[model samples]
Target: MPSSINPGATLVLTGVTHILVGLTHPRLGPPLLSMVRSGLFDSITGISLDPTSSGAPQYDRMAAWWFELAGAAMILLGISIRENINVAGYVPRGVAWGTLGVGVIGALVQPLSGCWTLIAQGIWMVGWFGKTKME
Candidate 1:
């Protein structure tokens, strides 16, 4: 087993993961989608983008749910391997990377929606990097 792991790190990792999951998968609706749709809000929030025109909101919702699952997995991994040479650090890193990847892909296929999600993910990734430390 790895040493030098602390409860604080585990808590932080879990908290961050929960935040990501919440952001991606709210109980009512995807705030990210709503935020992406409102032009005024997006611009004011510095996340300007157009609303989704695709007739597949359910597909998007399902995708978000899967992403949340992935985030949960990362959280568990971080907690389980908290002292494994900074593997825990990658949980947020993976979240950021995954978000960025999705954003990029979204941008390529759907510029407005993609860019909006990218902005949100970018902000989250920035926070993740700033808040966490490698062990």
Candidate 2:
């Protein structure tokens, strides 16, 4: 079946995908990793505690990884909404809520990194809100 979609929604989805791809890919990855390593970002954001000698967070890394994955998922979710509203139905409202939840958790844990994810999820949430179902 032809996708029941809107042009503006498609633009939003494509824009979000481009942003997520840029953030996650290798070109931007090292700079981001360097920021995390150097503590400059944390210093500016004021969210980090002292790390042990191993140079890792005292807490679990899973939440940070989850936030990144959620950002990627939001890109996919936007694509699905653009290409197929039926696929949108498969995603469930909970995914958006879950994304927002992760964003909040990530922000609390690592403000700088988390804020980017939060913005992505927030954009996706806006796209979702703007979408309309066509019979």
Candidate 3:
């Protein structure tokens, strides 16, 4: 048990960040793949289109889809956790920890884009009052 933990803010910020990342992937990830996928939206994102042309873009798209859903799920789960805990109930600590783990893994995987999540989730995890906070 930690001395101080503002589960509310933690859940809200982390949840929103995850949701935004997931939502943006679908909205923005496709254009970068236009040359590889063959479609309307066309542009360059600075990342070499070479890999996408190498047949790995298919898998890349699939992974992005997974991350999108994961983000949505995080939002829902975070809300549920906040609600359950605030009202006073048996919201298992494991649930929070597990969510944090998943979030951190995703953040670590894409530190460049997920930097916000990385820092936010890290704070949420430490379970500190002013700075870090985790379970």
Best by lDDT: 3
Residue 20 of model 3 has an lDDT of: 64
Rank the models by lDDT, top first.
3, 2, 1
Between prediction 1 and prediction 3, the one with superior TM-score is 3
Instruction: List runs of model 2 lying over 4 Å from the truth.
Output: 1-74, 81-91, 114-132
Any idea what lDDT model 3 has? Answer: 0.52
Q: Report RMSD (Å) for each prediction in the order shown.
A: 12.9, 9.3, 9.1
Model 1 poorest 10 in a row by lDDT: 39-48
Residue runs of model 3 more than 4 Å from their true location after superposition: 1-13, 22-28, 31-57, 89-91, 113-135
Q: What would the TM-score be for candidate 2 when compared with the true structure?
A: 0.37
Which residue pairs in model 1 clash with each other?
A: none
lDDT of 2 at 71: 52
Candidate 1 lDDT over residue span 1-135, tens digit each: 223544324434654655565574555246446535655231123222546433434444455545556556645644543443355443355655665676577688878542454445445554445434543
- The TM-score leader among the candidates is 3
Cα error, candidate 3, residue 90 (Å): 7.3
Clashes of 1: 0
What TM-score against the true fold does each predicted structure earn? 0.30, 0.37, 0.47
State each model's CA lDDT, in order.
0.48, 0.51, 0.52
Q: Between candidates 2 and 3, name the one with more favorable lDDT.
A: 3
